[model samples]
Target: MKIISWNVNGLRAAVRKGFLDYIESEDPDIIAVQEIKLQSGQIEIPLDDYECYWNYAERKGYSGTAIFTKHTPIRSFIGDFHPAADSEGRVLGLEFENVYLINVYTPNSKRTLERLSERLEWEDAFLHYVQQLNAIKPVIICGDLNVAHQPQDVKNDRSNIGNSGFTDEERSKMTRLLNSGFTDVLRHYYPERDDIFTWWSYMKTVRERNIGWRIDYFLISDSIVDQLEHFQVDDHIYGSDHCPMRMTINLH
Candidate 1:
C-alpha cells in the first residue's frame, strides 16, 4: 500500500492549485492531510471512490485533519483515543484489518515558544494514547508532527537551536517517542542522509534553496518495521509551504 501525508496549509487553496491533479497523478492508496482549515459542509471534495473522514476544529478555517482512503476501514476515530485538546481536529484514525493509521497535525509551539509548555503536555497525552493503541495493533502515525527531532532533521541546526520546533524539550519528546518502540520510517532506512527534508518556510528562496526541516514523519511500531518498503520526500510536488511525502508498505 502507498500512503501520502501532507500539511496542505489549506485544503481549499490547495485544490485551487491542482491538489486533485496531483492526487490523480500519484494515485496513492491513502492520503492523510493536515491543517485543512475548514468546517463541516464547507466544501465538497469530488473524490467518489475514497471514503473521506474529517475532524474539523470548532473554529472554522483553522486547524483540522482528514484522511481519504481507497479502502474501507472497519472503524474510524476522532477525539476518541486522543486527548480532549484534540477537539481542534488535530488527530484522527482509521482502523483497517491489519493496522491503525493515525493522522495528526501536532500543535505548533509558535515562533516565541509561548505555547511550548502546553504543546509538551499535549505531546505526553498524545504519546500515551498512541501507546494504548499500539498495545492492540501496530500503528502507522503519519503527519506534520511540528518538531525537528535531531540536528540532522533541521537545516540550520546551529542557528535554530532554541527555536520552537527545535527546542530541547520538543526534540526530547520525539526522542522519548522513538525510544518507546516507534521507528521513524525515513531515518530507519537512511539514518545519515541530511539532505532529505519535508517542510519549508514560505520566505523567499527558502524552498528553492532547499532550506527545510523534516518535521513531517511516518512513525510506526518497531514490530512492523519490515513492512515498510520505501519512503521518499516529495518536495517536488508543491501546493503549500510544506511538501508531500510518500511511503510504500507491504500491509496488504
Candidate 2:
C-alpha cells in the first residue's frame, strides 16, 4: 500500500497551492496530514475514494492531524494517554486489519524553547501510547515529528545545536523511541545520506539553497520492516514549508 504524509502547514492554503492536484497525481492508498489548522465544521475536502478522519484542535487555526484511507478502519481514536497535551489535536489513530496507523503532529518547542519541557513530556507520553498499540499489533506512524534527530538530519547541525528542534534533550527522545521498537523508515534505507530533507525554512533563499531539516517521518514497528516497499522524501513537491513523504509497504 502507498501512504503519503505531509505537514500541510494549513490545509486551506495548501489546497489553493495545488494540494488536491498533487493528491490526484500521486494517488496514494493512504494520506496522513499534519498541521491542518482547522476545527470541526470549518472546512471540508472532497476525496471520494478515501475515508477521511480528522482531529481538530480546541483552539482556532492551530495544530491538528488527519488521515484519508482507502480501506476501512476497524476502529479509530483521537489523542494519546495524556489528554491535556492533546488539546491541540495532535494524535489520531486508526486500527486496520493488519496494523494500527497513527497520524501525529508533534508539538514544536518554539523558537525560544519555551515549550521544550512540554514537548518532551509529550514525547514520553506519545511513546507510551504507541507502545501499547505496538503490543497488540505492529503500528505504522507518519507525521512531522518536529525534531531533526541526528546531525545528518539538519543542514547546519553544529550551528543549530541546542536550538528548539535540534537540542540534545529533544533528539534523545527520538533515539529512545527508535530503540523502544520502531524504525525510522527513510534513515533505515539511506542512513548516510545527508542531502535529503523534508522541512525547509520559508525565509528567502533558504529552501532554494536546500537548507532544510528532515523533521517529517514514517516510522514503523521493527517486525514490519521487511514489508516496506518504496520510501522517499518528495522535496520536489511544493505548497508548504514542509514537503510530502511517501511510504509503500506490504501487509500480506
Candidate 3:
C-alpha cells in the first residue's frame, strides 16, 4: 500500500497550481493533507474514488487537515488531544482494519519562540494520544511534524540551530517520540542522505537552491518496521512550499 502526506499551505491555492494533476500522477492509496486553511463550501475540489474527511479550525483561513483515501476507513477521529485541544484542526485519525493512520500538522513555535511552551505541551498530548492508539493497533503517523529532528534533516543546520523548527527542545521531543516505539521511516532507509529536504522557505530562489528542511514525515510503530518497503520525498512536485512525502508498505 502507498500513503502520502503533504502540507498544501492552502487547499485553494494548491488546487489552482495543479494539485489534482499531481494527485493523479502519484496515485497513492491514501493522501493526507495539512494546513488546508479552508472550510466546507469554500471550494469545490472533486475527489473521485476517494473518501474525503476534513477537520476545519474554528478560525477561518487558518490551520486545517484532510484525508483522501481510496478505501474508506471503518472509523476516524478529528481531535483527541487534551489540555490543548486540537482546535486548529491539526490532526486526523483513520482506522482501517489493520492499522491506525494519523495525519497531523504540529504547532510551530513561531520566529520569536513565543509559542514554544505551548508547542511542548502539544507534543506531550499528541504523543500520549498516539501511544494510546498504538496500544490498540499499529499506527502510521504522517504529516508536517514541524520539527527537523537532526542536523541531517535540514540544510545549514548550524545557522538554523536555535530556530523554531530546529530548536533543541523541539527536536528532543521528536526523539522521545521515536524512542517510545515509532520508526522514522525515511531516516531508517536513508540515514546519511544529505540535501534531501521536504519543506523549503518561500524566500526567493530558496526552493531552486534546495535550501529546505525535512519537517514532514511518515512514522510507524516500531513493530511494523519490516513492513516498510520504501519512502520518498517528492521534491520535484510542488504546489506549496512543502512537497509531498510518500511511503510504501507491504500489508501482507
Candidate 4:
C-alpha cells in the first residue's frame, strides 16, 4: 500500500493551489496531512472516494491534522495526549487490521526556543504513546515531526546547529525515538542521501535554491522494517512549505 504524509501549511490555501489535482494524480491509498490550518466545514472539495477523518484546533486557522484513507480502519483515535496538546488538533491515530497509523504534527520550538521546554515534554509523552500503541501492534507514525534529527537533514548544518529545529535538545529526542524501536524509513533506505528535503523556507530563492529541511517523516516499528518497500520525498509537487512524502509498504 502507498501511504503519504504532507504538511499542507493551510488546507484552504493549498486547495486553491492545486492540492486536489495533486492528490488525485498521486492516488495514494492513505494520505496523512498536517498543518491543515482550518476549522471543520470551512473548506470542501470532492474527495468522495476517501474516508475523511479530521481533528480541528479550537483556534481557527491554526494547527490541525487529517487522514484521507481509502481503507476503512477498525478504529480511530483523536487527541487524548494532554489538554494542551489535544487542543491544537495535532494528532490522529487509526487502528487498521495490522497496523496503528498515527498522524502527528509535533509542536515546533519557536525560533527563539520559547517553547523548547514544552516541546521536550511533548516528545516524551508522544514516545510513551507510541510505545503503548506498539505494544499492541506495529505502528506507522507520520507527519511533520518539527525537528531535524541529524546534521545531514538540513542545509548548512554548521549554521543551523543551534537553531530551533537543529538544537541538541530536539535532535536528542529524535534519537531517543529511533532508539526506542522505530525506524526512520527514509534514512533506512537512503542514509547518505543529500540535498533532498521535505520543507523549505518561503523566502525568495530559498526553495528555488533547495535550502530545505527534512522535518517530515514516516517512521515504522522496527518489527515492520522488512516490509518497507520505497520511501521518497515528492519535491516536485508544491502547494505548501512542505512537499509530500510517500512510502510503499507490504502490509501483507
Candidate 5:
C-alpha cells in the first residue's frame, strides 16, 4: 500500500495550487495531511473515493491534520496524548486490522525557541502515546515531525545547530524515538543519500538551491521494517513549503 504524508500549509491555498491534481497523479492508498489550517465548514476538499478524517484546532486558521484513505479503517481516534483537551488538533489515529496509522503535526519550537518547553513536553507525551499504541499492534507514524534529527537531515547544519528545529534537545527526542524500535523508513533505504530534503524555506532561491530540511518522515515499528517496499521524498511536487514524503508497505 502506498502512504503519503504532506504538510499542505493551508488546505484552501493548496487546492488552488493543484493539490488535487497531484493527488490524482500519485494515487496513494492513504494520504496524511498536516498544517491544513482550516475548519470543517471553511473549505471542502473534493476527494471522491477517499474516507476523510479531520482534526481541527480550536483556534481558526491554525494547525490541523487530516487523513484520506482509500480503505476505511476498522476504527479511528482523534487524540491519544491528552484526552480532555486536545485543542491543537495535531493527531489522527487510524486502526486497521494489522496496524495503527498515526498522522501527526508536531508542534514547532518557534524561531525564537519560545515554544521549546511545550514542544519538548509534546515530544514526551506523543512518544508515550505511540508506545501505548505499539504495545497493541505495530504502528506506522508519518507526518511533519518538526525536527531535523541529525546533521544529515538539514543543509548547513553548522549554521542551524541551535535553531528551533535543529536544537540538541529536539534532535535527541527524535533519536529516542528511533532508538525505541522505530525505523526511519527513508533513511533505512537511502542511508548514504545526501542533499535530499522535504521542507524548504520560501525564500527566493532556497528550494532551487536545495537548501531544505527533511523534517517530515515515515516511521514504523522495527518489526514491520521487512514489509517496507519503497520509501521516497517527492521534492518536485510542491504546493506548500513542504513537499510530499511517501512509503509503500506490504501489509499482508
Candidate 6:
C-alpha cells in the first residue's frame, strides 16, 4: 500500500492549483494533509472512492488536517486523546485492522521561540498519545512536523541554525520521538544522502535555488520497518510551498 503525506499550506488555494488532479494521478491508498486552513463544510472534495475525515480549527482559515483513504477504517478519531492539543485541529487517527494512522500538524515555534514552551508541551502530549496507540498496534505517523530534526535534514545548517524549525530544542524533541521506537522512513533508507528536502520557503529565489527542509515525514513503529518497500520525496510535484512525500509498504 502507498501512503503519502503533504502540507498543502491551504486546501482551497491548492485545489485551484490542481490539487485534485495530483491526487487522482498518485491514487495512494491513504493520504494525509496538513495546514488545510479551512473550516468544516466550507468546500466539498469530489473524491468518490475515498472516505474523507477532517479536523478543523475553531478559528476559520487557520491550522487544520484531513485524511483521505480508499479503505474504510474500523474506527476514526477526530479528538479525545488530548483536549487542549486537539483544539487546534492538528491531529486525527484511523484504526485499520492492524495499523493506526495518526495524522498530525505539529505546532511551530515562532521565529523568536515565542511558542516554544507550548510547542514542547504539545510534543510531550503527542508522544504519550502515540505511545499509547503503539502499545495496541503499530502506528503510522505523518504530516508537517515543522522540525528539520538534523543538520542534514535542512540546507545551510550553519546559516539556518537557531531558526524556528532548526532550533536545538525542537530537534531534540524529534530525537526523543525517534528514540522512542519510530523509524523516519526516508532517513532509514537514505541515511547518508543530502540535499533532499520536503518544504521550501515561499520567498523568491529560495525554492528556485532548492533551499528547503525535510519537515514533512512518514514515521512508523520500528516493528514495521522491514515492511517498508519504497520511500521518496516528490520534489517535482508542487502546488504549495511544500511537496508531497510517499512511501509504499509490503504488508504480507
lDDT of each: 0.91, 0.92, 0.90, 0.92, 0.90, 0.89
What is the clash tally of candidate 5? 0
lDDT of 4 by residue, 150-204 (tens): 8889988999988999999999999999999999999998899878899999899
Q: What root-mean-square deviation over C-alphas does model 6 reach?
A: 1.2
Clash number for candidate 1: 0
Displacement of residue 178 (Cα, Å) in model 3 is 0.2
Clashes in predicted model 6: 0
The whole-model C-alpha lDDT of candidate 6 against the native structure comes to 0.89
lDDT of 5 by residue, 172-206 (tens): 99999999889999889888776889999899999
Global fold similarity of model 3 (TM-score)? 0.97
Stretches off by above 4 angstroms in model 3 are: 83-85
lDDT of 3 by residue, 1-252 (tens): 899899999999999998899888889999999999998889876878899899988789999999999988999888667533467888888999889999999989999999999999999998899999999989999999999998999889999999999999999999999999999988898889878899988999999999989999999999899998888888999899999988999875
Question: Tens digits of per-residue lDDT for model 2 on 83-186?
Answer: 64468898898899899999999889999999998888888899999899899999999999999989999999999999989999999999999999999999
lDDT of each residue in 105-145, candidate 6, tens digit only: 88889888999888888888888989989999999999999
Error of 1 at 128 (Å): 0.6
lDDT of 3: 0.90
The global Cα lDDT (0 to 1) of model 5 is 0.90
TM-score of each: 0.97, 0.98, 0.97, 0.98, 0.97, 0.97
For model 5, give the 10-residue run with minimal summed lDDT.
Answer: 79-88
Off by over 4 Å in 5: 83-85
Per-residue lDDT of 78-128 in model 1, one digit per residue for the tens?
A: 855445346789998999998999999998999999999889988898889
